[model samples]
Target: MKLEKSIIGMVHVQALPGTPNNKHSIEEICEIAVQEAKTYEEAGLDAIMIENMHDVPYLKGAVGPEITASMAVVARAIREVVNLPLGIQILAGANKEALAVAKAANFQFIRAEGFVFGHVADEGYIDSCAGELLRYRKVIGAEDVKIFTDIKKKHSSHALTADVDIDETAKAAEFFLSDGLIVTGASTGKAVYLHELKSLKDKVQIPVLIGSGITAENLEEYWNYASGFIVGSHFKENGFWKNPISKDRLKVFMEKVKQLKK
Candidate 1:
């Protein structure tokens, strides 16, 4: 499907502290997520994607039931208040669980890492999951929920997939039936290369979204090639991902994007 030039707000929900990571609880995390979702909606973002970014020291495969259940509950609550399109993303390529949550919450899409290419991420080796993930979606009857795969994904080592260039990798994803393609930088919250964005846009027929490091200053330059943007870090305090989402920052960013769209 064709994607319009729009701004997609990233809501990095805080994970419950003390389970293995920090000091927040599931309830606290959910509360923050709900509030952030409302803020993003009120800020007039085109869409919102919920992610367990704080669930650092991420698990390789399935995160236990508590994490999934907690995220689902929070995601469901966000869906209730936000009328914009909602998407879910779990860390470390848990595509099946993400699809299930999107299905249960009636979310529109999922941001999947390692969807079409094999890469070694911060956690460990992440194998391609297009075949199994699609089949899981089909079996669960959630085909309407789009899969946005990341090409040359951030925070991962793609040297193993070095034989395939960015353009060919994007083409492969399209051939494998990815609903959309995400182009990110080397790590989380990093900015993607405009040249890489152009190369992928020139190669793929599907929508191309900028997945990291979007800011008010660079929004216009990327608008020419990006169908949409997944902005997070710059929207946070001091432009750091670990910080809270800054309402003032969001307001300014959205204003610039609105002007560009006009």
Candidate 2:
């Protein structure tokens, strides 16, 4: 919850066991995750977020115990290797399950989608889980696990809330007690509209993080408004999240962020 405009690198764990893209064994997956996390820490990034992004064709929520169990194992491995603040996020709005993984793995935060407003995602309709998720967090004694929720999340249809503007939507999340808010573009790896970010920054009191598409070219442009950046694609080879982490790409982006901080 205390993140300041710091660089947060993404550790996109390969397809977990039981998913379609599962080629690596669980041991192999964890080893890769730990290595990537260490690379981010060594590269001077402030924090690392571990996500099951490769688990494509995701279920809407409660994606079986295997998903949560696999995530906890990977998270625990990374937790042991790096001192950077660690975060976990379950695909397709499984916020409570994500909190469970965070608690089990001793993570500091979770990037949650569908914390407010309902949307038709590729998997199905995702309803607001703020009430259920917060109560569950309290029950597990994981109040320290901050929730950074996505507003107008990428890869979803918002036509259901066409009458509501983003400012109003953000206020709703704030009212619902979100730890912080994430603003993203239309899909993964897409850049957010600067005007939308600026508008939200002026109106929202809590932290406003850019959840996608922050490259060296636009870091300065977004630096003025975003409290933090949850980056995955820009750090990967050729700006693709599924590719291996590119030290060369990360170096250039971090250098730009360093200059912007000054």
Candidate 3:
């Protein structure tokens, strides 16, 4: 699937079984996830992505099979409900596990971190996963599942690779075969700089997505440059990713997107 110029809604699934903040049973998690996916499709999102974001203080690199198992259930449930393209992200850089889940669930793609340069994320050190992850995808027969990687990913210190600028990072990821690139501010809910975004657009051949802080109010600033927007916080009740997806907010946001398309 060629994913370009898509308004992809972030469907952050409730904490799945085995995480510290997990409150719902596996069934409950799947139910809530399916409903969120349904709402995003009904509101006109081009695609919806499921994330284990609520699994706070995430694991450093690998996740247990239970995490993968529950995600499979949720992903399948969401697939059953929504006809739009669906994707997955296993937090804290579990790119291989996420690919396995995406394949089992028949998901279209996955959002990944630590695909190129090393970073010290809040969870701990995340090593580059590109070589292993891509090989794993081939072994699993999931070459069609695209991997959209984060460059200088949010909420982390890049001092380790400070010498390597964003442009260098973009070339490296491309050399490593990333299907797309993501640009973000320092953290979630923070806006990506248009100048920096333009710089990246000038630097890379792959699709560039704004990974955070996109709202109806600021959509125009990025629409001309970004091929996609991975929106989460802006669709919630109070612009919080933790809050449930607000249909009214989504409707209003999509209305603005429609006008921009004109």
Q: How high is each candidate's TM-score?
A: 0.96, 0.98, 0.98
lDDT of each: 0.86, 0.90, 0.91
Residue 64, model 1: Cα distance from true site in angstroms? 1.2
Model 3 lDDT, full chain set: 0.91
Tens-digit lDDT track for model 2 on 1-262?
4778978999989999899988999999999999999999999999999989999979897688998999999999999889989898999788888999999888999999899999889998999999999999999999999999998889999999989888999999999999899999999899999889889977879999999888889888899898889889999898888899999998998888888878
Candidate 1 global CA lDDT score: 0.86
Residue pairs whose backbone atoms clash in candidate 2: none
Task: Tell how far residue 68 is off in model 1, in angstroms.
Answer: 1.2
lDDT of 3 at 185: 89
Residue-level lDDT for 173 in candidate 1: 95
Better of 1 and 2 by lDDT: 2
Clashing pairs in 1: 17-23, 17-24, 18-22
lDDT-better candidate, 1 vs 3: 3
